[model samples]
Target: MLAALVLLLLTFALLLWPVAVTGGIASSLSYCLSALVPSLFPFMVLCGFAVESSAALWLSRPLGFCARYLFRLPDCCAAPVLMGLIGGYPAGARGTSLLLEKGRITEKEARRMLMFCVNPGLAFTVTYLGIGVFGSPALGLRLFLSVTLSAVVLGVLSGLFSPLPSPDKPGAERMESRPGALTRSVEGAARSVLLMCAFLLLFSGLSALLHEAGIFQGAVRLLSRLGVFTPNQWAAMLSFLLEVTGGTGDARALGIGPGFFAFGLAFGGVCVHLQVLAMFRKPPIRPPLFLLCRLAHGLLSAGAFALMGVISPMENASTAPVMAGIYRPELSGGWRGGASLALMCAAFLLMVPGETGKSSLRAPGPKLISVAGVKFPLQNR
Candidate 1:
C-alpha cells in the first residue's frame, strides 16, 4: 500500500515536472553517446565473445594456478573475473550468470565471485573519471589501481575463508564452440548495452524529478541541520549513492576529494547495482552480502586512493606523470597489444576449481546462449 502510494505520488511529480525529466534524460543520452557507449559497448562484445567462443577457457589457462592457490577456485572461474575487471558492471554479472547456467560454476561459487566481481571498467575509470573529471589521467590511473587492488584483496580474502567446493561437478568443462558465436555475442552485447542505457535514462529522469521537487534539497538541508555534512558535500554524497557518473562529476565540481570519487566508482551507485541484478533470473547473492561487500569495496578503494595521493600526489597536471600517454596509439603499440598484455597478467592472477579430472581436450556438449530472455542451444561444430 505504501509502495503504491509512493508510486502514485511519484507519477504526479513526474507529470508536474516533465521538462526537468526530459532535460535530465537528454543529458543522460548525451553522456551515453559520448562516454558510456564508447567505453562499454565494445568491451561488452569482446567479453561476451571470449566466453561464448571458448576463448575464455583457453585464455584463462595461464591463470589456472593462481585461481587454485589464491582464490581456491577452478581455472574456468578466472574467465569471469577477468571479464568483471575489464568489461565492468553487467559484463561480470552476465559472465557469472552464463557460467552458472552452464553449470561451469556452482551457485555458491557464483555468490562468492559476486563479492569482488561487477567492477567499473578501467576505461571508464581512467578515461572518463581520470581525464574527463579530474583533468589528470594519471590520477585516474591511480584510482583504477586502487579500485583493482581492493577487489583483488576481497577476492583473495573471500577465497581464503570460504570452503572450497567439490572439484568434479556434473556438466562442468563441457562447453562447446559453435558456429555464429561471434554473432550471438554481438547480439547479446547490443541488447545488454541497450538495457543499461535504458536504466541510465530512467534514473536520470527520476533524479531530475526529485531535484525539481526539492527532495534532494530537503535532504541536504536536513543533513546540514544535523551538521552531518556541508550542503555541497551532502549533495555530492547523495549523487554518489544514486548515480556514479553524475556523482563523480558532482564530486569534482563540489571540490570533493578524489577518494570520494574512487568510492563512487567502486560502489557503482544504485544504477549499476540494478543493472547487475537484472542480469540474473535469480540473484545469486543475498542483498545483505551484496551491500556489505559494496560498502567494503567503497571504503577500501577510498583508503587506497588516499594512500596513493599521499605517496605520489597527481593533482597537479604539470607534475603528474603522463600515464594517459600509454593509451595513445602513437605512443604505444596499440590498445590491442596493451589488452593482450593485461590479459596475460590477469590470467596469472586468477583461476577457479571445477571439472577436476576431466581431460581438457574432451569433446564438449552444446553451448547455450541467452539473448533477450530467450535461450537456445548451439550445436558444437
Candidate 2:
C-alpha cells in the first residue's frame, strides 16, 4: 500500500512538473543556506568536538553525585545526557554508545539511557524553530523548555528504574594505546555535521515533494471537515507528522498553535529519528521501544504546550508577532559569537574531569580524560 502510494506520487511529480516541487527545493536550499548553516552547522561542529574532547570524562566527574543518586547511573552517564540535550539528536546516543564501547555502561544501562537521553539541542530549537521558522523567539523558547523538561524527567525516571551496571565489568582499552585523538575529533565533527546537513536537505526536498503532490492538502481537507480544526490546523499537524522541518514551516504558515509546534518538536520528525538510528548502527537498537518512547514524548510535549497556552496571557499563537532575524554567511560576531564563546567554555568545562596533573598542549598531544583510572580517549573510536 505504501509503496504504491509512493509510486503514484513520483509518477505525478514527474509528469506534472509541479511548482511545489521546485518551491520545496528552493525553500530547503534557502533555509539551509540561511538558517540551518548559520544556526545548526556550527552547533553540530561543536557537538562533534565535544564528543572527541576530554570534556565527556571531565564533565562526568563534577556531576557524578547526581548520576549516582539522582539518575541512579554511573557518574560517567551525566555528560552524555547533558551533551545529548545541548548538542541535539545522536550526540547523547553517541555518548551512550561510547560508554558501552568503553565498557563503562552495560548493554542494559545503555538501552535505558537511550530512552531519555536523546533530543534536539537548545541552539537548534532557538535558532531554527524559534527564530527562523516561527519568527517568534517565545515559541521556540517554549518548545525548548517544554522538551527539555520532558527529557530531564524521562532521563531521571530511566535512571531510577534501570539497574546500575556492575562495577566489575572491564572497561574499554586504555586511552594511551589509541591513535592521536585531537585530529580524530576535528575530522569526526566535520563528518557528523556534513552528514546531518545532507539529511536536512534530503528531508526538505521530501517535504516539498509531498506538499506539491497534494497529499498534505488532501489530508488537511479531510481532517478539516471533521469539524474539530480548521484546514490550516490540519495542514500544520499533517506537515509535522510527515517531515519536521517542512511540517513546522507549514504549521507556521497556517498559524495553528503553539501546542502543535511543541508536539511537532517532540516528535522530532522522521528525519531526526532516522539520524538517531543511523548514528546508533552498532549493536542493533530496539526500535519498538524507542518508537513508543518517541510517541509518548511527543504527546507529553503537546500537553505541556497546551498547559502553557492556558496559563500565559500572551497573544494567541495565530495572532502573535514573529520577530524576524537576519542570517549572514560572514561571522560579524553577535549571538553567533556569544554562542561560540559559550561553546568554548562548555568544552573547556568538560575538560575538567579526569586525572588532574597531565597538562598536555592541544593538537598532536594526547589529551587524556581518565575516569576512575580509565582513560577516555579523545579519538573517535
Name the candidate that leads on lDDT.
1
Over 1-381, each residue of candidate 2 has an lDDT whose tens digit, in order, gives: 999998896777756755545555666777667655565555454444444555555555576667777667876677676777777776777667666765667787777777776677788788667766666678788888788778777777777656654322223123412454556655655666566667776776666555445454566566766878665666667667666777665565545667777777777777777766666556445777887877777888877777777887556444233555444455459888788779979888665555765435333553332322333222110
Worst 10-residue lDDT window for candidate 1 reads 372-381
Q: For residue 258, give model 1's deviation from the true position in Å.
A: 0.8
List the pairs of residues colliding in candidate 2. 55-350, 58-353, 102-172, 239-247
Residue 210 of model 1, lDDT score: 68
Report the Cα lDDT for residue 266, model 1. 89
lDDT of 1 at 347: 60
Q: How far is candidate 1 from the true structure (C-alpha RMSD, Å)?
A: 19.2
Alpha-carbon lDDT, every model: 0.75, 0.64
Task: Give the TM-score comparing model 1 with the true structure, all chains together.
Answer: 0.79
lDDT of 1 by residue, 1-381 (tens): 999999999889989988878877898898888888888888788767766776766666676666667777766777778878777777778778777876777888889788888788888888777776667778878888999889888989988776664443323343466778789888988888999999999988878876767676677667767766666667778788898877765566556667677788889888888888787889989887898898899999999888887888664543122344456455346787788779867765444224655444445663433322323332110
Superposition error at 156 for model 1 (Å): 1.2
